[model samples]
Target: MAAKGLILLLFFSGLVSSNVEKTIFLAPEAREIAHDAVLLGRRLPVLTPSNWSLRTKIDAEFPTEGSSQGKVSWFFLDNLTEYQRYEVRICWAATQPTAFTLKTYEPSVAWEQPDLRASIERFVPNSQQQDIRTGVAEPTSDQPRISSALVLQVSAAADYFTKNATLMSNVPLVDVDVVLDPYILNVFPRSLLPNAACIVLVAIGSFFVSRWVIALIDGLLRADAALEKKQQ
Candidate 1:
């Protein structure tokens, strides 16, 4: 009966341990920027004024489709005013026993337009420079024209089942190798190593406990036998 109770306790402990999940955040990459000038190189004759707009699509590396955490954004700078705006969209997923549901988050300010513009100007000042020459005079540089097209920011979360649990139906096992970022993982507590030394310590402790229990039982049995012999 004691052994059976111990086995049941161990089974419940295993079940609890197997349900742990690990979540990580992943940032999205900008594949290509959309704009009229980018499509038709600058060499093309300047035709009518260009009204530039762009769209980008993102997909998870694993599980192809469904809920995941990430952000998509569209960015543009008003060259005349030297101000920038990042229109962002964020989404995330929660997994259930039966299905996964995607939750979309409302877009909010990621960075101030003026601050973004200032940073860009400081890093790439020559980016705004242009070249011109005066007749019979030295050539002079002018501010380079900034592209109307903007690159959007994309961020997402990569989650994995760390515990020993069966995959749900229709859920694809993500096989992509992920190198965990040490900076982020440091925030979470990890399992201690189950080394040989620890195992030996546990075994020795169990052996002593079992011996003590068995000795008590054997003493009781002997007392009962001696009493019966005396009665006879």
Candidate 2:
């Protein structure tokens, strides 16, 4: 029973240790924006890495469909960071291909428009997934301009490419997630050594504890046998 309790305690500890900060958005599958651009609702402001550690995740609040499920959002993310190794993952439930475009920009004070520095585009097929990761290796450069587009089948159906028109979606829901600290930490082997050590220590401790209990039982049995002899 004690061993069963210890196992249950360890299982619960793993669950508690694995929780992450989650922020959800009822992001549009598609929306027309300024300059005939397609965006996934408003800009998302992301905040992170205050102490050189950044972990964020964007995913559907649940597997449900339609707009009624999630919180209505504008500029969905609250902040974004640069000069860090990060990953941007977009997952959806549609069977049609979704055009995922990431546009990067440098803000300008004049309000004319932010300068579009770089644009990354991918046509994700069968609505599988589009994962964008920066710093694939050691020496990595900055990634992304800012906004995103999860254009679901609209471009496939209409002239969204040439018209530069913002459009809506036929599909139900989409989510963007940013949380991946555990994966990033594992990239460096040293980050995992301490956790491995802790597991070994626990196993060793449990073995020693069981041995002590067994020895105590044996000693008590021998003493009872001696007492029986004396009684005889």
Candidate 3:
């Protein structure tokens, strides 16, 4: 019974320990700005990293069709980072080289991590680091020279692209809005309730086994006395 209880405890501990914590950083303003651009029938801001022009805008809040059920977005010319993915877009627009706004999802811990800031600098260097300001103005040009063509494809497959865009760019870098911290911490200590419940179950099972063993021993002793009395 003791061995059984120990085994059960170890098993539950392993299961709980296997839970991993993951972190990701994201600029919600990018998505918000993209949504507004799509709603107002306007082209989103662009940043050209290499010879290929790169543009980003959030198209849908949730992906309707895709293996990854993340928010839908349009990524032109591939600026996919290790943590970022682009969805479908309605049209492609010219790259705009201008100062862009980048607001963090979590302002408290956004700039605290040095590694995240380094990644942003390494991937996109032209963006000026500024305090996160709310209610940023949208870009509007009175004389629009180019028109965006429609994309007839219903949905894109799982494969976005083979290579990362930052590795292949050769053109002058433009200021692209990037969030320094893209990940949030998720602690699994909340799982302790289930672990405690399992431990209680093991205890109850052990109690029953112990009781059965005691009853069996008592019955054997009583039978031995009865047989001795019959022999006498």
Scored by lDDT, the top model is: 2
lDDT of each residue in 146-201, candidate 3, tens digit only: 22211111121121322656422322232222221112122222224578789999
Candidate 2 whole-model C-alpha lDDT, 0 to 1:
0.32
The estimated TM-scores of all candidates read: 0.24, 0.30, 0.27
- Tell me the deviation in Å of residue 18 in model 2: 7.8
> lDDT of all predictions, in order shown?
0.31, 0.32, 0.31
lDDT of 1: 0.31
lDDT of 1 by residue, 1-77 (tens): 99999999998776643222223322222222223323212211111112122122222222334424322212221
- The predictions' CA RMSDs to the true structure, in order, are 20.6, 15.3, 19.0
- Pick the TM-score winner: 2
Q: Per-residue CA lDDT of candidate 2, range 59-90, in tens?
A: 22221354223222211221232222333233
Please report the TM-score between candidate 1 and the true structure: 0.24
- Ranking, lDDT, top scorer first: 2, 3, 1
Poorest stretch of ten by lDDT in candidate 3 = 150-159
Model 1 spans with C-alpha error above 4 angstroms: 1-199
